[model samples]
Target: MSKRGGSRNPSSERARGRDREERREREREREREREREREKRERERETEREREREREREREIEREREIESEREREREREREREREREGERGREGERHWKNRREGHDGEKSGVCVCACTRERERERERERERERERERERERERERERGRERE
Candidate 1:
Protein backbone atom coordinates (compact mmCIF):
# COMPACT_ATOMS: atom_id res chain seq x y z
CA MET A 1 0.00 0.00 0.00
CA SER A 2 1.31 3.50 -0.88
CA LYS A 3 1.47 5.83 2.16
CA ARG A 4 -0.82 8.82 1.58
CA GLY A 5 1.30 11.01 3.86
CA GLY A 6 4.54 10.47 5.69
CA SER A 7 4.46 10.32 9.50
CA ARG A 8 6.76 13.44 9.59
CA ASN A 9 4.26 15.93 8.11
CA PRO A 10 5.06 19.67 8.67
CA SER A 11 1.55 20.52 9.99
CA SER A 12 1.67 17.57 12.38
CA GLU A 13 5.14 18.67 13.55
CA ARG A 14 3.89 22.23 14.15
CA ALA A 15 0.89 20.97 16.06
CA ARG A 16 3.09 18.69 18.23
CA GLY A 17 5.46 21.61 18.92
CA ARG A 18 2.50 23.80 19.88
CA ASP A 19 1.19 21.06 22.20
CA ARG A 20 4.60 20.76 23.88
CA GLU A 21 4.79 24.56 24.31
CA GLU A 22 1.34 24.59 25.80
CA ARG A 23 2.25 21.84 28.23
CA ARG A 24 5.43 23.72 29.19
CA GLU A 25 3.43 26.88 29.80
CA ARG A 26 1.00 25.01 32.00
CA GLU A 27 3.89 23.47 33.96
CA ARG A 28 5.44 26.91 34.48
CA GLU A 29 2.15 28.27 35.74
CA ARG A 30 1.82 25.39 38.16
CA GLU A 31 5.35 25.94 39.44
CA ARG A 32 4.69 29.63 39.95
CA GLU A 33 1.53 28.88 41.92
CA ARG A 34 3.35 26.31 44.07
CA GLU A 35 6.13 28.81 44.77
CA ARG A 36 3.59 31.44 45.73
CA GLU A 37 1.82 29.00 48.04
CA ARG A 38 5.10 28.04 49.69
CA GLU A 39 6.02 31.68 50.22
CA LYS A 40 2.62 32.38 51.76
CA ARG A 41 2.99 29.45 54.16
CA GLU A 42 6.45 30.64 55.19
CA ARG A 43 5.16 34.14 55.89
CA GLU A 44 2.34 32.71 57.96
CA ARG A 45 4.75 30.68 60.06
CA GLU A 46 6.99 33.66 60.61
CA THR A 47 4.04 35.69 61.74
CA GLU A 48 2.99 32.99 64.18
CA ARG A 49 6.50 32.84 65.63
CA GLU A 50 6.60 36.60 66.07
CA ARG A 51 3.24 36.56 67.83
CA GLU A 52 4.44 33.84 70.18
CA ARG A 53 7.50 35.89 71.04
CA GLU A 54 5.41 38.96 71.82
CA ARG A 55 3.09 36.92 74.00
CA GLU A 56 6.03 35.54 75.92
CA ARG A 57 7.39 39.02 76.44
CA GLU A 58 4.03 40.20 77.73
CA ARG A 59 3.79 37.28 80.12
CA GLU A 60 7.25 37.98 81.48
CA ILE A 61 6.46 41.64 82.02
CA GLU A 62 3.26 40.77 83.85
CA ARG A 63 5.11 38.35 86.08
CA GLU A 64 7.72 40.95 86.87
CA ARG A 65 5.08 43.56 87.73
CA GLU A 66 3.24 41.10 89.94
CA ILE A 67 6.44 40.25 91.76
CA GLU A 68 7.21 43.89 92.34
CA SER A 69 3.70 44.53 93.64
CA GLU A 70 4.03 41.63 96.05
CA ARG A 71 7.31 42.97 97.35
CA GLU A 72 5.86 46.45 97.76
CA ARG A 73 2.87 45.06 99.63
CA GLU A 74 5.15 43.13 101.96
CA ARG A 75 7.14 46.25 102.66
CA GLU A 76 3.93 48.18 103.31
CA ARG A 77 2.69 45.53 105.73
CA GLU A 78 5.99 45.57 107.57
CA ARG A 79 5.90 49.37 107.84
CA GLU A 80 2.39 49.27 109.21
CA ARG A 81 3.34 46.71 111.84
CA GLU A 82 6.36 48.82 112.83
CA ARG A 83 4.22 51.93 113.06
CA GLU A 84 1.72 50.17 115.29
CA ARG A 85 4.51 49.03 117.57
CA GLU A 86 5.91 52.53 117.73
CA GLY A 87 2.50 53.96 118.60
CA GLU A 88 2.04 51.46 121.40
CA ARG A 89 5.52 52.19 122.68
CA GLY A 90 4.87 55.92 122.56
CA ARG A 91 1.65 55.58 124.53
CA GLU A 92 3.32 53.44 127.18
CA GLY A 93 6.20 55.91 127.51
CA GLU A 94 3.81 58.84 127.64
CA ARG A 95 1.99 57.29 130.56
CA HIS A 96 5.29 56.71 132.30
CA TRP A 97 6.43 60.32 131.63
CA LYS A 98 3.14 61.70 132.96
CA ASN A 99 3.85 59.86 136.17
CA ARG A 100 7.38 61.40 136.47
CA ARG A 101 7.98 63.91 133.56
CA GLU A 102 11.15 62.20 132.22
CA GLY A 103 13.14 64.24 129.64
CA HIS A 104 14.50 60.99 128.16
CA ASP A 105 10.95 59.82 127.38
CA GLY A 106 10.20 63.11 125.63
CA GLU A 107 13.32 62.79 123.46
CA LYS A 108 12.32 59.23 122.59
CA SER A 109 8.87 60.42 121.50
CA GLY A 110 10.46 63.13 119.35
CA VAL A 111 12.71 60.55 117.66
CA CYS A 112 9.78 58.20 116.98
CA VAL A 113 7.77 61.05 115.48
CA CYS A 114 10.69 62.00 113.25
CA ALA A 115 11.11 58.41 112.11
CA CYS A 116 7.41 58.12 111.36
CA THR A 117 7.45 61.30 109.29
CA ARG A 118 10.49 60.08 107.40
CA GLU A 119 8.77 56.77 106.70
CA ARG A 120 5.69 58.55 105.37
CA GLU A 121 7.80 60.70 103.08
CA ARG A 122 9.66 57.66 101.83
CA GLU A 123 6.39 55.88 101.18
CA ARG A 124 5.15 58.84 99.13
CA GLU A 125 8.35 58.90 97.11
CA ARG A 126 8.10 55.20 96.45
CA GLU A 127 4.51 55.59 95.30
CA ARG A 128 5.48 58.33 92.89
CA GLU A 129 8.28 56.22 91.51
CA ARG A 130 5.94 53.25 91.10
CA GLU A 131 3.43 55.43 89.26
CA ARG A 132 6.12 56.70 86.92
CA GLU A 133 7.28 53.18 86.22
CA ARG A 134 3.74 52.09 85.47
CA GLU A 135 3.28 54.99 83.06
CA ARG A 136 6.50 54.19 81.28
CA GLU A 137 5.49 50.57 80.95
CA ARG A 138 2.14 51.59 79.55
CA GLU A 139 3.76 53.86 77.00
CA ARG A 140 6.17 51.15 75.97
CA GLU A 141 3.32 48.68 75.64
CA ARG A 142 1.38 51.09 73.48
CA GLU A 143 4.35 51.66 71.25
CA ARG A 144 4.96 47.96 70.89
CA GLU A 145 1.37 47.25 70.01
CA ARG A 146 1.21 50.07 67.52
CA GLY A 147 4.33 48.88 65.78
CA ARG A 148 3.02 45.34 65.39
CA GLU A 149 0.01 45.15 63.12
CA ARG A 150 -2.29 42.51 64.49
CA GLU A 151 -3.51 39.73 62.23
Candidate 2:
Protein backbone atom coordinates (compact mmCIF):
# COMPACT_ATOMS: atom_id res chain seq x y z
CA MET A 1 0.00 0.00 0.00
CA SER A 2 1.60 3.12 -1.29
CA LYS A 3 0.48 6.73 -0.14
CA ARG A 4 -1.56 8.04 -3.01
CA GLY A 5 -0.80 11.39 -4.58
CA GLY A 6 0.96 12.83 -1.47
CA SER A 7 4.24 14.68 -1.79
CA ARG A 8 5.21 14.34 1.99
CA ASN A 9 2.27 12.71 3.90
CA PRO A 10 1.59 15.97 5.84
CA SER A 11 -1.85 14.72 6.95
CA SER A 12 -0.39 12.58 9.76
CA GLU A 13 1.60 15.47 11.18
CA ARG A 14 -1.44 17.81 11.07
CA ALA A 15 -3.59 15.16 12.84
CA ARG A 16 -1.03 14.69 15.64
CA GLY A 17 -0.71 18.45 16.23
CA ARG A 18 -4.52 18.81 16.47
CA ASP A 19 -4.69 15.93 19.03
CA ARG A 20 -2.07 17.54 21.29
CA GLU A 21 -3.82 20.91 21.19
CA GLU A 22 -7.15 19.27 22.14
CA ARG A 23 -5.51 17.53 25.13
CA ARG A 24 -4.09 20.81 26.39
CA GLU A 25 -7.52 22.54 26.08
CA ARG A 26 -9.15 19.72 28.07
CA GLU A 27 -6.57 20.08 30.88
CA ARG A 28 -7.21 23.88 31.07
CA GLU A 29 -10.95 23.31 31.38
CA ARG A 30 -10.45 20.84 34.27
CA GLU A 31 -8.17 23.31 36.08
CA ARG A 32 -10.75 26.11 35.76
CA GLU A 33 -13.45 23.81 37.28
CA ARG A 34 -11.25 22.99 40.26
CA GLU A 35 -10.59 26.71 40.93
CA ARG A 36 -14.36 27.46 40.82
CA GLU A 37 -15.05 24.68 43.35
CA ARG A 38 -12.45 26.05 45.75
CA GLU A 39 -13.91 29.59 45.52
CA LYS A 40 -17.42 28.25 46.30
CA ARG A 41 -16.14 26.42 49.38
CA GLU A 42 -14.51 29.59 50.75
CA ARG A 43 -17.72 31.59 50.22
CA GLU A 44 -19.75 28.94 52.15
CA ARG A 45 -17.38 29.14 55.11
CA GLU A 46 -17.66 32.94 55.28
CA THR A 47 -21.49 32.76 55.28
CA GLU A 48 -21.49 30.23 58.15
CA ARG A 49 -19.26 32.43 60.28
CA GLU A 50 -21.48 35.49 59.74
CA ARG A 51 -24.61 33.58 60.76
CA GLU A 52 -22.98 32.30 63.96
CA ARG A 53 -21.91 35.81 65.00
CA GLU A 54 -25.47 37.11 64.53
CA ARG A 55 -26.87 34.40 66.80
CA GLU A 56 -24.40 35.25 69.55
CA ARG A 57 -25.37 38.93 69.45
CA GLU A 58 -29.05 38.06 69.74
CA ARG A 59 -28.40 35.98 72.88
CA GLU A 60 -26.48 38.84 74.51
CA ILE A 61 -29.36 41.29 73.92
CA GLU A 62 -31.85 38.87 75.48
CA ARG A 63 -29.78 38.58 78.63
CA GLU A 64 -29.59 42.36 79.04
CA ARG A 65 -33.37 42.71 78.73
CA GLU A 66 -33.96 40.07 81.40
CA ILE A 67 -31.63 41.82 83.83
CA GLU A 68 -33.36 45.20 83.33
CA SER A 69 -36.79 43.69 84.01
CA GLU A 70 -35.62 42.11 87.25
CA ARG A 71 -34.19 45.42 88.49
CA GLU A 72 -37.47 47.24 87.83
CA ARG A 73 -39.50 44.67 89.76
CA GLU A 74 -37.19 44.94 92.76
CA ARG A 75 -37.55 48.72 92.82
CA GLU A 76 -41.33 48.45 92.76
CA ARG A 77 -41.33 46.09 95.73
CA GLU A 78 -39.15 48.46 97.76
CA ARG A 79 -41.49 51.37 97.08
CA GLU A 80 -44.54 49.42 98.24
CA ARG A 81 -42.82 48.49 101.51
CA GLU A 82 -41.96 52.13 102.18
CA ARG A 83 -45.56 53.20 101.65
CA GLU A 84 -46.84 50.62 104.11
CA ARG A 85 -44.47 51.84 106.81
CA GLU A 86 -45.59 55.44 106.33
CA GLY A 87 -49.26 54.50 106.71
CA GLU A 88 -48.60 52.71 110.01
CA ARG A 89 -46.82 55.72 111.47
CA GLY A 90 -49.65 58.06 110.49
CA ARG A 91 -52.26 55.91 112.21
CA GLU A 92 -50.31 55.84 115.46
CA GLY A 93 -49.90 59.62 115.50
CA GLU A 94 -53.63 60.18 114.97
CA ARG A 95 -54.51 57.96 117.91
CA HIS A 96 -52.15 59.81 120.21
CA TRP A 97 -53.63 63.21 119.27
CA LYS A 98 -57.18 61.99 119.93
CA ASN A 99 -56.27 60.77 123.44
CA ARG A 100 -54.68 64.15 124.33
CA ARG A 101 -57.83 66.04 123.28
CA GLU A 102 -60.11 63.82 125.41
CA GLY A 103 -57.96 64.38 128.53
CA HIS A 104 -58.07 68.17 128.07
CA ASP A 105 -61.90 68.19 127.78
CA GLY A 106 -62.29 66.19 131.02
CA GLU A 107 -60.08 68.64 132.97
CA LYS A 108 -62.07 71.66 131.74
CA SER A 109 -65.37 70.15 132.88
CA GLY A 110 -64.05 69.55 136.45
CA VAL A 111 -62.91 73.19 136.80
CA CYS A 112 -66.32 74.47 135.69
CA VAL A 113 -68.15 72.43 138.38
CA CYS A 114 -65.86 73.77 141.12
CA ALA A 115 -66.54 77.40 140.12
CA CYS A 116 -70.33 76.96 140.26
CA THR A 117 -70.19 75.52 143.82
CA ARG A 118 -68.22 78.54 145.15
CA GLU A 119 -70.74 81.04 143.68
CA ARG A 120 -73.67 79.26 145.40
CA GLU A 121 -71.96 79.45 148.84
CA ARG A 122 -71.37 83.24 148.58
CA GLU A 123 -75.07 83.94 147.76
CA ARG A 124 -76.28 82.02 150.88
CA GLU A 125 -74.03 84.08 153.18
CA ARG A 126 -75.37 87.42 151.86
CA GLU A 127 -79.01 86.39 152.51
CA ARG A 128 -78.29 85.38 156.20
CA GLU A 129 -76.69 88.81 157.00
CA ARG A 130 -79.70 90.73 155.69
CA GLU A 131 -82.07 88.74 157.92
CA ARG A 132 -79.96 89.43 161.10
CA GLU A 133 -79.99 93.21 160.48
CA ARG A 134 -83.85 93.25 160.22
CA GLU A 135 -84.24 91.30 163.53
CA ARG A 136 -82.09 93.83 165.52
CA GLU A 137 -84.26 96.75 164.38
CA ARG A 138 -87.48 95.03 165.86
CA GLU A 139 -86.33 93.68 169.28
CA ARG A 140 -89.97 93.19 170.64
CA GLU A 141 -90.80 90.85 167.79
CA ARG A 142 -87.29 89.33 167.81
CA GLU A 143 -88.36 86.48 170.17
CA ARG A 144 -91.41 85.56 168.03
CA GLU A 145 -89.30 85.87 164.84
CA ARG A 146 -86.63 83.65 166.38
CA GLY A 147 -89.31 81.05 167.33
CA ARG A 148 -90.73 81.24 163.78
CA GLU A 149 -87.26 80.84 162.30
CA ARG A 150 -86.60 77.81 164.57
CA GLU A 151 -89.93 76.22 163.71
Candidate 3:
Protein backbone atom coordinates (compact mmCIF):
# COMPACT_ATOMS: atom_id res chain seq x y z
CA MET A 1 0.00 0.00 0.00
CA SER A 2 1.10 3.70 -0.62
CA LYS A 3 2.23 5.82 2.45
CA ARG A 4 -0.60 7.69 4.13
CA GLY A 5 -0.95 11.22 2.76
CA GLY A 6 -1.39 12.82 6.22
CA SER A 7 1.85 11.45 7.69
CA ARG A 8 4.17 14.29 9.06
CA ASN A 9 7.97 14.61 8.71
CA PRO A 10 9.39 14.83 12.25
CA SER A 11 12.77 16.34 11.28
CA SER A 12 11.17 19.14 9.27
CA GLU A 13 8.90 20.03 12.21
CA ARG A 14 11.88 20.23 14.57
CA ALA A 15 13.76 22.50 12.17
CA ARG A 16 10.77 24.86 11.93
CA GLY A 17 10.52 25.02 15.72
CA ARG A 18 14.21 25.90 15.99
CA ASP A 19 13.72 28.71 13.43
CA ARG A 20 10.89 30.22 15.49
CA GLU A 21 12.99 30.11 18.68
CA GLU A 22 15.89 31.92 16.97
CA ARG A 23 13.56 34.68 15.71
CA ARG A 24 12.16 35.19 19.20
CA GLU A 25 15.66 35.47 20.65
CA ARG A 26 16.61 38.07 18.07
CA GLU A 27 13.50 40.12 19.03
CA ARG A 28 14.40 39.87 22.73
CA GLU A 29 17.91 41.16 21.98
CA ARG A 30 16.50 44.14 20.05
CA GLU A 31 14.21 45.00 22.99
CA ARG A 32 17.17 44.90 25.40
CA GLU A 33 19.18 47.22 23.16
CA ARG A 34 16.30 49.68 23.06
CA GLU A 35 16.03 49.60 26.87
CA ARG A 36 19.76 50.32 27.22
CA GLU A 37 19.48 53.27 24.85
CA ARG A 38 16.62 54.73 26.90
CA GLU A 39 18.63 54.46 30.12
CA LYS A 40 21.60 56.18 28.51
CA ARG A 41 19.38 59.06 27.37
CA GLU A 42 18.00 59.49 30.89
CA ARG A 43 21.53 59.63 32.34
CA GLU A 44 22.57 62.29 29.86
CA ARG A 45 19.56 64.44 30.78
CA GLU A 46 20.37 64.09 34.48
CA THR A 47 23.97 65.21 33.88
CA GLU A 48 22.80 68.29 31.93
CA ARG A 49 20.44 69.30 34.74
CA GLU A 50 23.22 69.05 37.28
CA ARG A 51 25.46 71.25 35.18
CA GLU A 52 22.76 73.92 34.93
CA ARG A 53 22.24 73.94 38.68
CA GLU A 54 25.94 74.35 39.28
CA ARG A 55 26.16 77.29 36.90
CA GLU A 56 23.28 79.02 38.63
CA ARG A 57 24.91 78.51 42.00
CA GLU A 58 28.12 80.05 40.73
CA ARG A 59 26.24 83.12 39.51
CA GLU A 60 24.61 83.58 42.90
CA ILE A 61 27.97 83.43 44.61
CA GLU A 62 29.36 86.10 42.29
CA ARG A 63 26.48 88.42 43.07
CA GLU A 64 27.01 88.01 46.78
CA ARG A 65 30.70 88.80 46.45
CA GLU A 66 29.98 91.99 44.51
CA ILE A 67 27.54 93.17 47.16
CA GLU A 68 30.09 92.53 49.89
CA SER A 69 32.67 94.51 47.99
CA GLU A 70 30.33 97.47 47.60
CA ARG A 71 29.62 97.49 51.30
CA GLU A 72 33.33 97.49 52.07
CA ARG A 73 33.89 100.47 49.77
CA GLU A 74 31.11 102.39 51.48
CA ARG A 75 32.67 101.76 54.87
CA GLU A 76 36.01 102.98 53.62
CA ARG A 77 34.48 106.20 52.33
CA GLU A 78 32.83 106.88 55.70
CA ARG A 79 36.11 106.35 57.50
CA GLU A 80 37.84 108.85 55.25
CA ARG A 81 35.15 111.45 55.92
CA GLU A 82 35.59 111.00 59.66
CA ARG A 83 39.35 111.42 59.36
CA GLU A 84 38.92 114.68 57.40
CA ARG A 85 36.58 115.99 60.08
CA GLU A 86 39.14 115.23 62.79
CA GLY A 87 41.87 117.02 60.89
CA GLU A 88 39.69 120.08 60.43
CA ARG A 89 39.01 120.17 64.18
CA GLY A 90 42.72 120.07 64.94
CA ARG A 91 43.40 122.95 62.55
CA GLU A 92 40.67 125.06 64.14
CA GLY A 93 42.14 124.44 67.61
CA GLU A 94 45.57 125.61 66.44
CA ARG A 95 44.11 128.77 64.91
CA HIS A 96 42.25 129.53 68.17
CA TRP A 97 45.45 129.17 70.22
CA LYS A 98 47.35 131.48 67.88
CA ASN A 99 44.59 134.10 68.11
CA ARG A 100 44.66 133.96 71.91
CA ARG A 101 48.42 134.48 72.00
CA GLU A 102 48.22 137.45 69.58
CA GLY A 103 45.50 139.08 71.69
CA HIS A 104 47.62 138.78 74.86
CA ASP A 105 50.61 140.44 73.18
CA GLY A 106 48.53 143.24 71.73
CA GLU A 107 47.00 143.97 75.13
CA LYS A 108 50.47 144.88 76.51
CA SER A 109 51.94 146.62 73.45
CA GLY A 110 49.05 148.50 71.77
CA VAL A 111 46.57 151.21 72.81
CA CYS A 112 43.17 149.87 73.82
CA VAL A 113 41.43 151.22 70.68
CA CYS A 114 43.90 149.61 68.27
CA ALA A 115 43.81 146.32 70.19
CA CYS A 116 40.00 146.23 69.94
CA THR A 117 40.10 146.77 66.17
CA ARG A 118 42.64 144.06 65.66
CA GLU A 119 40.56 141.66 67.76
CA ARG A 120 37.48 142.38 65.62
CA GLU A 121 39.44 141.70 62.41
CA ARG A 122 40.76 138.39 63.75
CA GLU A 123 37.24 137.33 64.81
CA ARG A 124 35.85 138.15 61.36
CA GLU A 125 38.62 136.16 59.66
CA ARG A 126 37.90 133.14 61.84
CA GLU A 127 34.19 133.32 60.98
CA ARG A 128 34.97 133.51 57.27
CA GLU A 129 37.24 130.48 57.52
CA ARG A 130 34.52 128.51 59.31
CA GLU A 131 31.99 129.37 56.61
CA ARG A 132 34.41 128.30 53.88
CA GLU A 133 35.10 125.01 55.61
CA ARG A 134 31.36 124.27 55.89
CA GLU A 135 30.93 124.87 52.17
CA ARG A 136 33.89 122.63 51.35
CA GLU A 137 32.51 119.79 53.48
CA ARG A 138 29.16 120.02 51.75
CA GLU A 139 30.82 119.90 48.33
CA ARG A 140 32.90 116.88 49.28
CA GLU A 141 29.84 114.99 50.48
CA ARG A 142 28.03 115.73 47.25
CA GLU A 143 31.00 114.54 45.19
CA ARG A 144 31.33 111.37 47.24
CA GLU A 145 27.70 110.48 46.68
CA ARG A 146 27.98 111.10 42.97
CA GLY A 147 31.13 109.04 42.50
CA ARG A 148 30.03 106.14 44.68
CA GLU A 149 26.56 105.86 43.21
CA ARG A 150 27.89 104.90 39.78
CA GLU A 151 30.32 102.24 40.97
Best by TM-score: 1
**Clash count list over all predictions:** 0, 0, 0
- Residues 1-151, candidate 2: write the lDDT tens digits: 6667757658988999999999999999999999999999999999998999999999999999999999999999998887777762565444443444234446422222233345776788888888887877688588889999999
Error of 3 at 137 (Å): 36
Name model 1 segments beyond 4 Å from true. 1-7, 89-151
Arranged by lDDT with the best first, the candidates are 3, 1, 2
TM-score of each: 0.55, 0.48, 0.53
After superposition on all C-alphas, the RMSD of every candidate to the true structure, in Å, is 20.3, 29.7, 14.8
Ten-residue region with minimum lDDT total, candidate 3: 105-114
How many clashing residue pairs, candidate 2?
0
Q: Between the candidate structures 1 and 2, which one is better when assessed by lDDT? A: 1
Over 1-151, each residue of candidate 1 has an lDDT whose tens digit, in order, gives 6556746678988999999999999999999999999999999999999999999999999999999999999999999888788874576556544444235545433333344556888999999999999999999999899889663
The models' CA-based lDDT, in order, is: 0.81, 0.74, 0.82
